[model samples]
Target: MKRRNFLSLGSALAGSALYAGAMPGAAAAGRDRLRIGMIGTGMRGQVLLRELVRRDDVEVAALCDIEPIMLGRAVQMVTAAGKPAPATFGENGDGYAYRRMLDSGKLDGVIIATPWEWHAQMAIDAMQAKVPVGCEVVAGVSLQDHWNVLDAQLKTGTPYMLLENVCYRRDVLAVLRMVRSGLFGELVHLQGGYQHDLRAVKFNSGDPTKPYGGGVEFGAKGWSEARWRTEHSVRRNGELYPSHGIGPCAMYTNINRGNRFTRINAFASKAAGLHDYVVRNGGEDHPNARTRFQLGDIVTTTLACDNGETIILQHDTSLPRPYSLGFRVQGTRGLWMDLNRSVHVEGISKPHEWDDARVWFEKYDHPLWRKYGEQAAGAGHGGMDFFVIHAFIEALKENAPMPIDIYDAITWSAITPLSEQSIALGFHTLDFPDFTGGKWRTRKPIFAFDDRY
Candidate 1:
């Protein structure tokens, strides 16, 4: 695709994919339309399902989940679109929804928004079935799951992506511009975290209709309440949730462009509040209580990439605070701590100390900001949700490389569990997995959504 035309496609398809380089009128077959099925109907799944249904070039042909109620809800949505309602699967049993969707010749790909643990397995299953897959990330739920998926991708010869949507955030695009344009000279250290207070949400593992917190864990195996956390407690670090904070940071460091994380060391707070709250809140207290969560409530994960630049990723969900994922990137020249407080060559510390971060950061009058700034700057998480979905679809339709790929997905997700291991140990430094076999640095950069940079 031509350079200008590539950008045009990105802005056009929004967040879906198409067969790029094909003849203009060749994308006519129903198969060319890229039929997609959704697995898992929870929070994340619902969002992706709703989002994809809006794209005219795509069709959702399957909706699957263990819970009949959720499946029914999704079916209602499909009917509302005036499209054929999806064939529901996994009404009972282990709920192999992805596999069920892949069985249909009508589906060319699947989007998995299942719990983190099932992500790898479902993705691999889809690939094996010769279906393209877009999976939710935090990397893989298990070390072995990671290995299996990578191998599967290479073997199946299908497009596989971990949806690290945060790469499309508005402020994030601004940061990328700074990096590509050399505003943040040689960004050496970056900081990010997904610190939300999920300690209070009540979940029931035996029942999918209830809150999704209790009695669920992600691993090579699917959701298991067997460990007993689901029966009566909360668990963290069991799944290593990453797709949130890690997404944007990975893009900033150019993980796909060969900047790889060389090492990481991390620590987690001792399990306290969640466990105590579970026991206090009528959760069954039993022998496994001691074994329930060795993971700390607060986990501070540090990443050191091959470029010798490190990014700090923190996940603290046990705390009872307002939802926040601090995306802080610091370079030798200028540093940005939040949405506003950016210090290029002057007044860096002043902005950091002030309240109302936007008061200092919002530069609505800036040229780049003025150009592609309004809707996104105020959209989901400052309009990032829209930007990311939009960019992904356009790139797929154009057959352009996505900014976040499997390589980025692996490294970013790997940090969570790897750092958990580090924190489990006495803060020992562990060599980060070479997801790309160490060839990451020599790769050419892909076009970022923010062309202004």
Candidate 2:
């Protein structure tokens, strides 16, 4: 049932008034089943689907994607677990299948893995419909998608969360505990980076054999070949794809906590050896081939928060660099960096200490993760995906604030587009709009809801 219908049903049961406590049957049948639908289930969609299926309290009531191929695997995933076959639909016929399904079903919430451009549009529609939303990547395509979610959430009174999964990393969570305990003191500045090479993970026109046709998160029959990057590239020049690289640190510094971003400047390098390598590696006759990459090889951005704290962000897609996201946080007392898959803390008479991500989990001799962590670990990003979704589901069941709340999302996602615009305007300082209207000042911390601590 819709939120309105649910509310009215409660009113009818209790004649003229309602109490802080629940009515008879209302308390018996709790909100155990949350009717949910998913949009954009490509690779990332599959990751979230695995997480959603684990909980007995929720079910994937509906599934929508642009291609039947994408939905097939997701369908098999949920059903193979003994759940009934969901009411499945595909926009393979049209790109708007997600919208049509939203109108037809009674969805309590939605998990959108749709492309960056559509992030704001679909999420806004879900919020307007009074459906809680958990979305991936970009907060808004332009100013409109950004402000629309803010207004819609306020007007309709629904939860709008950005599905930034990194905040749930076990090591990151342990780091938060350390920070909360003041192990990392008065963080003054930090650095974040998302560097990956997809040269082997070819896109539509990007491959020589044309193995897979163009159809991504925002699927459509003929979605202009050049439309790819607009949906994917996190940093045009030096914008931080904070969801992955900067996400954990945003939590550490309390981005939406008390300190927030004020302005940023992005500087990108010109075409490098890799650009020429990709070109020379391919013959001149590669049709519809890449001309000049807008997101040059490497990009660097510098941000200063309201508290006079600074953060350095770096982005790169070329070169055979190691697979890693550079994370560094510096404080008045000490500094922390994870460079070689090991965190190093220093700034003392003696170097603080260095520990691998495993060290934190080692002490988890406590079995919170052992029973639940195995299969999710078998799935994606060493199971961080499950951690994020688990946090979201528990929040709904308990009426607690979201771990990655709307403000957290807006603060992190805002960096992408603004960084692009900053590079476009030649590093001129651009204002980072606070979509929260400043309510972040007093809002409770969302992650504290975790009972595991």
Candidate 3:
């Protein structure tokens, strides 16, 4: 039934009576069936949609996108999956269509994969409507938006997750198990970053005729376009996309639980990569050719945790570099380095030498992967996406708190804006906000590698 007609019927037959009949209990929620709505039918959204509907327990009840083509494709995918075609809202002028779906009372939750700017607002609105939200990464673009999301989650007590797939990576999770088991010893320092080259994607004047395409070359595509990401290259100076690297590091370091970031200082290399690319390809007369990108080719952010450990975060996408999270976990006993896929355990190995960590990865393979890795291998991003979605759905069906909760989402995303402020001010040490308000000190870790899972 449509929400409007349902509301009318409820008004005709007493409000409380209707609501009581419609709302389900914890027992019902735990029954494995979860009806969900998806917002933003872009490539990322479509990829997740394919993963989500693969489960018999999940139903894509609704879809929202600005473009009809994208919305139609999603509808077809759902119907092709032997599920009923989902209701769709494609009016892109304003995002009231998203709000309408939230108010419809048909969804158990919503998955948001909209562009970076819309992430905070969409998740906030879903939580405000008393619906759980599983959103894509970079929780917010600005620091205030980060606080906005935190406030909304706190105010509503609704489940909010960042959907950081990297945390579920097989190797990363294996390393996580080692960290928890004292294989890494007392965690002393760590480093990670989003260092993948996105120049082609950032500069790809997206085709406008196809679904998720429709942006003028070298111009902002209103709100939804490849220009949105590229525009960040022209304006921001800090870790623009930090979650991919920071999420796993935060998990391994027990951030927002036992350890909290206290302060940060950042430095940026000169902005040359993007401009140089534009000039080398498109002449000096091109719009981006002469434009001075505020974002440096390489931005390095150093953070100090309240527990006295240090973290180094690097953003090096604009330049020519191979994809690497650069995940480095160091402790009193040993270290795990992603670049070399090696580990150095003090007593287990020769003095001051690194040994292949592949052995440890195999021996300490995370329980989740040991069981489901073969199954998860079918999904995208080397199967990391599968585990991320699986974790969220499992938590939701069981009515447990999200594995990557609101505090983790906000804390990791806030690094971007904080780093920007630090870099702009001559690398001044900026104090990090305690979003947990000291609860981190007492809150036990919820994201642990369980053999039972």
Candidate 4:
């Protein structure tokens, strides 16, 4: 489809209240089966494909990937599910093969799970093709890339959602309910982070059979994420992956809906984790051990919001540590910390003591989880992946605006580049751009506002 034609169609679709308010059952009179496409059929793409095929309302119409092995595996998965074989792209290793899929007029929507650098341009092309997008984390690598995406969505009026599943995590959602119910009592400060060791994920043998943790190889000599993800550690210094931590925190503080981040400051520890891993796993004589990694072993960023709430986010992926988002939601009355799974209420608990968070989580489990917990079993990421993907497909079928919309996508992603700039300037604070263009003052929180998918 031509860009101009798609823009007109998108504008007309926008006029039909597609981007307005939620209208349950609105799309029942529309299509009975939605046609979906997959881009970057790597490990993450395979997981999403598994969930998509599990649904009766979705048809896996097309698949695209530069890697022939991954693409073939995805096709086999669909056919094994008793669905028709999807049209495949990128057999010849053309990076732009996704453009052909987008222009094929066969896809109602596209789910992107490509490397970090390719996210923005691919999403822009999909939106311009009049296809809704459910994109993976970190919308763009640069600040201007984010603005460009925002401009494309604004101009085309296409639906774009960040496939950030962490926001729907059971305990996170429970804490969100607590915040909204005034249990937190006027939010003050919050903290969350990507504090997991990724040494094994960053290095692997090029052989697909040994997908992870057998050798210290990256870039062209690695498989799956190790092929691309580790290169960022060698070339950049920033909070490269921020959505997993910031998405839920944004919900708690109402970011981009009557609240927005205004400024940010960041700091980074010395770069040693990746190099140490290389030396430990492959010895000092390994070629990768001599490669200078620019990314810090630990990166910390602090953000100030318009509503006086403060947020601290840490990016600590290269070190040795158990996985944790290290969430701490504090307010006037009390606080909840995920690190120890404990909560403290000024009067609810014994003075200066902790209560097991499990009781609180059970008492206030998210309504959506309570309703779909059984169905979500076996879905990735503790079944939160089911919720995020469900929200995308349901919104498409209902013709409603996405729960986590374009503004939310860029707002969370812009943190990476902004943090890099902050760290470059010796931990100096920088102004956070308002991607909503002043609409944040009036925009309302729609994420997980109801139990409906």
Winner by TM-score: 4
Listed in order, each prediction's TM-score against the native is 0.79, 0.82, 0.90, 0.94
TM-score of predicted structure 3: 0.90
Q: Please estimate how well model 2 matches the true structure, expressed as its whole-model Cα lDDT.
A: 0.63
In candidate 3, position 64 carries an lDDT of: 95
Deviation (Å) of 28 in candidate 2: 9.0
Better of 1 and 2 by lDDT: 2
Compose the digit string of candidate 4's lDDT tens values, residues 277-355: 9999899999998999999999999999988889999999998999999999998889999999999988898999999
| Model 3: per-residue Cα lDDT over 1-453, one tens digit each | 221232232224321210011224644668568999999987789889988888898989999988776788888889899999998886565666899999998888899998898999999999999889999998998899999999999999898978999988889888876876677677788999989886766765456443232322444632234556778877789988888888888876667765688998899999888777778776777665677789999899998987777999899988888899999999888999999989999899889888998998999887778788787877999998888888777667867667788998999999999999998899899999999998877554444555322
In Å, residue 374's CA in model 2 sits off its true spot by: 4.0
Tens digits of per-residue lDDT for model 2, 1-453: 221232233223222211121234532444777877898767678788887887788888998886676678789988998887777777455777777778874887889986667778888788776778888867876656667766777787687777776666666655555554444556677877777664433234433233243322111212322234433432345463656776877766666655677788888787463445445555455422354446656778788877677887777765567766777766655555667545444553347556664664354322335446665666467777776677567556655456577777777777777887888887788887876678646443334312331
- The most accurate candidate by lDDT is 4
RMSD for each of the candidates? 6.5, 8.8, 10.4, 6.8
lDDT (Cα atoms) of all candidates against the true structure: 0.61, 0.63, 0.80, 0.89
Query: For model 1, how does the per-residue alpha-carbon lDDT over 1-453 read when each residue is reduced to its tens digit?
Result: 222222233344322222112234322422335577888876567766666676676778888888676678788877787778778888874566456568777775677876667778888888888877777665475677777888888787766767766665546655654555555566678887877776534323434444444542322221322222232223445225666887777666666454667778887667776566555543455433343655567778777766667787777766567777788876666666663444443344444343343533353222334454564454345545544555455445544444466666676777666765776577888887887775664554443333321
The alpha-carbon lDDT assigned to residue 321 of candidate 4 equals 92
- Badly placed stretches (over 4 Å) of model 2 are 1-30, 202-240, 272-274, 341-372, 449-453
Residue 337, model 4: Cα distance from true site in angstroms? 0.4
Regarding lDDT, does 2 or 3 come out ahead?
Answer: 3
